[model samples]
Target: MKVIKSNGEIEDFRADKLINSLIRSGASIEEAQEITNIIQLKITKPTPTRTIYRLAKNLLKRTNISSSMKYSLKKAMMRLGPSGYPFERFFAKIMQAYGFETEVDIVEEGRCINHEIDVLAFNKNTVVSVECKYHSSAFRASDAKVAMYVYSRFKDLEDKLKKKYHKKRYEGWLVTNTRLTIDAIKFSRCYSFKAMGWRYPEDGGLEKLIEKKKLYPITVLSIKQDSLQKLLKHELVMATDIIRISNEFLENLGLNQRKINQLKKQARALLG
Candidate 1:
């Protein structure tokens, strides 16, 4: 059977790939095999990768809640938005957790134009103007056009900054919830712009960075939509934020001790 990848490329589907993914997410050998068997029996035609992911997640949820949660991390990131702003804020928090001072939604004057940066992250030596591209859907990717735009903006800023703010090196970055197109990756590399996405850079992509820093979004938890919205409305985004809050505060949210404990356990497991 053919499988449509997120980038819209069609390829032959391999059941072993599905099994390996499940095993990587902490499913046992037997459970992974069983899930793969079920999926093979059910899937008759070409399927989109997102549909397969959803099916796997559903099966995993029935077998192991923790594994299901783990598998859902990328989807949870996609859920961080009806708009890109929330994801930008979440990205800023992740940057902060990694020791970079960050500012969101800053309008800075470039050499010839004013640019609104999604996130500005800096420390002692490096300053990065970030363009955060968030997509509500998992299948969409940041393409070459995005790369070109961000690169132009970066060049303008770099030109302006060199004449004034000369001490710290300035850079540009494009971060996204989904993957980047091949052209996007090529352009970024050619221009010395850092492009980060769900799986870009292979080793240090957004997912790896989040895992390394133990900075997971609150949406990753298996919570009721109403409760999750309440937390989001209060600007509570991180799993660590939930852990840091007092028991009284959680009680005020109408969560029982049992539910709170479950959340805590899930959050901690995600961090590791």
Candidate 2:
């Protein structure tokens, strides 16, 4: 059967693709297969990709709620938007979770001009100037222009960044919530700087890294808008943060006991 993609492209549907996605979202092989078989039986017409996504999500929820939440990882990343600042902060937290000292939304004095870096990550060996390209639309990607811009800023500040951070090795990096265009990957190869997105770098892409640390964003959980806004307002972005906060802290933020329990339950399921 054929399926309609979100970008309005019609293509043959592959059951294996759906199975793999389910497995990645934390489903066991048995569960993934079961769900895919059901979806295949249901799709007699050329259904939109979003409809398939919803159907899979619903089935996954029935099988495993935690996997259902994880299945929405890409969508949850987009929910951090309307403003890229949240992504910047969330990226910094991801860095910190991996033991890199990070700063977000900082201005650094480059040799030729001042540059605003989205995230500057420092380890014992290297300093990286990171630019985060956040797009609300899943189909949109970071193109060559983004790679060029980040590379230019890196060239201007490489020396200063190294000296200031006391790291001999330095890099200009592009990190996006979406995919990278082919030209963008090509441009990054030309300059030898890192340009990474959702599935880039094969083994260590953004989602892989996040799953490695269980550092999912708070937006991934099933929560009401008001509770989510309050969490964002308090600068608590990581799902694990819900695990760390005191009950009183959550109460002061206007979250009732039931809401608090729900957050903790999902957070533990994701992180533990």
Best by TM-score: 2
Residue 205, model 1: lDDT of 95
Quantify how close model 1 is to the true structure by its C-alpha RMSD in Å: 3.3
What lDDT score belongs to each candidate, Candidate 1 first? 0.85, 0.89
- Candidate 2 displacement at residue 197 in angstroms: 0.6
Worst 10 residues of 2 by lDDT: 159-168
lDDT by residue for model 1 over 51-153, one digit each (tens)?
A: 9878988999898886787677787897786767778889999899888999889998898899999999988888889999999987799999999999999
TM-scores across all candidates? 0.82, 0.95
**Candidate 2, residue 90: CA error in Å?**
1.2
lDDT of candidate 2 vs native?
0.89
